[model samples]
Target: MANRGRLFWKILLGFWLIFLLTTQLLWAVFTLYNPRHEAPEDNIARRIGNVQIGTAGAVLARGGLQALEELKASWPPDERKFFSDSPVVDAPPQGEGALPSMQQTRGAVSRLVMAPDGQRYLLRYDLDGLRNEYHQGRRSSILHMPPPLFWLGLTGGLLFSLLLAWNLTRPMLQLRRAFERVSRGDLSVRLFPVMRRRHDEITDVAKDFDSMAERLQVLVSDREALLHDVSHELRSPLARLQLAIGLAHQNPKNVYASLDRIEHEAGRLDRMIGELLALSRAEHQGALGEDYFDLLGLVEAVVNDARYEAQVPGVDIQLTAHQPEDYTVKGNAEMMRRGVENIVRNALRFSAHGQSVFVSLSRVDSLLEITVADQGPGVEESKLSSIFDPFVRVNGPLNGKGYGLGLAITRKVVLAHGGQVEAFNGPGGGLAIRLRLPHWE
Candidate 1:
């Protein structure tokens, strides 16, 4: 649950820390690599020693009286260690082959650092000389290398932070544009967000919003179409029936039949109106599944009412219960019974003579399942969905039958009750219409 400000600062601080750490490392290495450790190239002792070393070798070879007498007569005993008297190394006087050996421990003033040849040596230097040479190298390295890499890293990090900010802000802009489109009544807007492989909650929220917008678009479109079609269809039957009733006195019995037909059409039209109203209300009713009614009683009443107008095909309503008692449901009872009646009526309308219209209401797992089936020619699979749409008829062109709002009404009622309705081909070659409602066990 990291907050936005916290996350932003975390990333910014992360980049800044990297730049600072790298610069510090480079600065440390530059400071530590002083060039004073290596041996100097040339020294003052080498030049001074080259002139005196040869003469001192000869002077020590004839050291019987002249060398020792000269060493004591001219050389000061206090300065004997500072100045070498001779370099006849390990010589012995009056021996077969030997030279005088005199050694002194003077300070390392360009000390004769032997080149390891045991015959020649390189002269070296002291503290003041080492410091003066090392200072220049250390100063130059510090002045040049560390500053450039540090500034380069700083600049790169700043640019990187900017690029990262741009990357994050771009997706937000896309979502804004999508919202703008939706505001202007284009509801099909979708966003294709660009991100790394990680999944964040913001991405999930955007997806959920997109899904909600899609459902809203579909429902609005359907409602608009339903309104237009209902208005258009209602006007026709109402105008015709009014005209037919206005002229009902020409032949008494035939006029009565005309009125009855008009009444039937009027009743059908009224049912359509009621269904459309229910559809409208259900869209806004939220959830109202508190009411429970007997599913068996509802189906029985609807089927018996359907038998009144059923002449061509006799109504054969059957109820098969796994349990003997009536199975009740939690729904609007009147609305649910009307829904079932529409299905039974439609089945009776389409079925042939002696063909049965079967109905079953049962309870299974806290669900009341009602199935109304008929031995009529089953609807085509393609037309099944269309038939649920208002004014879409399953009757062929030859049979100009009732308005096709029955199934649509049934679907509306089922949905309002938090239930589902479906149609399919029965196992034994018939149209099987089923409704499922939540029931109290």
Candidate 2:
């Protein structure tokens, strides 16, 4: 779980950094390309070059350097042009490499001077430096930007990306801790609701995690109850067996009765274990064995099988349906049958002898409704909710003289088929168990 958050942040930061760096570099490149807008083969620069050539000619005339060169006096044409009329000042370095008039315009000429080699120079008289004055009017060159601006942008983008990563990962970290605790046997922990988004994917994930954790806690609690009930159930049979052994060694006449009690208790234990096993199988298989069955026929079969052991002397169970033999529903056959039998058995046990028990099979809308009603005393209103809990015997000893796992197992079976079971006092008198199942072909 921790790994999930880490992976999310890594991918988030990786993509964001990639996009940030690439976009920043692209912007720099476009800016660099925008300023190289020099016109090709310009005429202004050519006129500037001719002006320098003419200036070079005047410099040659002032000293008659051409005549000295023609006489072969071992003097350079530029050396003869040195003026003796006034003491010469030192020139800026590389006056010989100055630009021609074609490269220097009217505004550029003021900063330029012609040398004897037909070259123009941008001579800054006040500055007396070799560097050109780049800050002239209407022809400003690109200025170098300060280096800190790029650093500022990079730092800001990184901070924003990290903030986004945190927002995406914080709730995941909290959820991981909750899941870890639950996995390690702490079923009470809950994930902190750090993500408050109503419709986003993260919010959906959070809600699902909360729901799963809640369900897990309920299951864990139910398992604890099952373990407790099983242990208590085992003790009774073991105690009976111990008493029977003690009696057999002492009193032969009472041995049979003691042994019979032991056998009966052992049988109860076997049946309880079997019911629990069946419930477990039903839960594990889920809907694997689901198929359509006639609801009325299924109920009738369950009624006959459950009452095979004994029947109440004065109760009449009638099956009434709007339509006969066609109220089919989708469910596991054995589990559904047992579930119906449990409800019928419960009604038979609770209702008074010689009283009527009504078994109704019908469909309401899209549901198959099977109700077991009896004319017996009912339980407290609050006990209705917990009546289906395992080992919950509201009527003391039932007809089978066994623990009350039937209703619990019955509830489990009903739930596996996407159905619901409910208990309430009948409208007239006594209690009713209603089973509602989804109907399908």
Candidate 3:
């Protein structure tokens, strides 16, 4: 039930969190890429220390301390800063041996070798300075190593997230407005063409919304027309009954005639009420069950009953089904019978004298196709699609035979059983109604 804006924020935040976690994971992986974490001995520093002292000691060995001083004076200014101490020359003290003991000055300079004579030489090297230079170099390399790539990734991720969030939220916002319009009785609202460029679940939802709106518009129109027709139908019979009652009151001697007329009108009213109830039930019926029965038998029964009741001059009702056995289908047998009976009776009512109403049944693939064709004048081409709507009666010679709920009820029943009904003008003449129902395999 959350709104699209809220959902968009939620999705964007989730994606951002994922991106942050991915960045952290990459940093961790890169930082720990060096498997050897144990600190190795400072071999480079030691090598620098050894070379400095060895070169100084070689100078002192080859020349005397004064010659070494001259050699140091001739060195570069950068190299002169290391020897910030005075040299010492001494022999082994009274009880000590001539062997040299390791000694360092300022934690950097150390004694490399003792002079061959009783005299000793000193060396100066700054180990701490060497370490500072090494660490600074490392820190500089780490901070400056291609930072642009990370910035580019961050910018790209932010833009992509914003774009994706907008794509998802914009459609939902449009759909929310569409729902609001539909709720306000705007059945003409549509989201198809607006979202047609998008190919996703949002587009699918838009398509469904368009279809639902279309169906709702049609149903609303049909219901309004049905209400108008029902009022007209009931008014006629009630007006006749009122007139009959008034006449009876005026002339008591002629009450029998008025009573007969009243009875006829009452019967017609009752039939109309019954048909309306039947139409309502057919429209709102639940799922059909597996009450498999002979469809052909049902059709035959309808045809026989219609033939006996046929009042049209010289009109005949005939069945044209020729099969080894009856066609069986799964559904409420009574409902199917009523549906077929309505089409046949409607056909019988319209046919002219000497005309035959043909009822044919056959299996077409997985369906039982039943068709009823009459020789009566077909309906208007423009009205053909709505002929099965409630209270929709074609303007023809036999229009007064019954209220227009028969074919409507027939359509409802057929649709309830997962079937369809269609009416079209027959090629030769008159109208043909076809009912296609799923047959039991």
Per residue, candidate 1 scores C-alpha lDDT tens digits across 51-147 of 3343434443344325534754564554333333322334332333332232222223332221112222222223333344445453344434545
Measured against the true structure, the TM-scores of the candidates, in listed sequence, are: 0.56, 0.73, 0.75
User: What is the alpha-carbon lDDT for the whole of candidate 2?
Assistant: 0.66
Q: Write the per-residue lDDT of candidate 2 for residues 346-381, one digit (tens) a residue.
A: 777776667777888888888888888888887778
Candidate 3 local lDDT, 140-162, one digit each (tens): 44333435445655676667677
Q: Report residue 383 deviation for candidate 3 (angstroms).
A: 4.6
Candidate 2: TM-score? 0.73
Tell me model 3's lDDT, rounded to 2 decimals.
Answer: 0.77
lDDT of 2 at 303: 69
- Which model, 1 or 3, shows the larger lDDT? 3
Give the range of the ten consecutive residues with the poorest summed lDDT in model 2: 123-132
Better structure of 2 and 3 per lDDT: 3
Residue pairs whose backbone atoms clash in candidate 1: 91-99, 91-100, 92-99
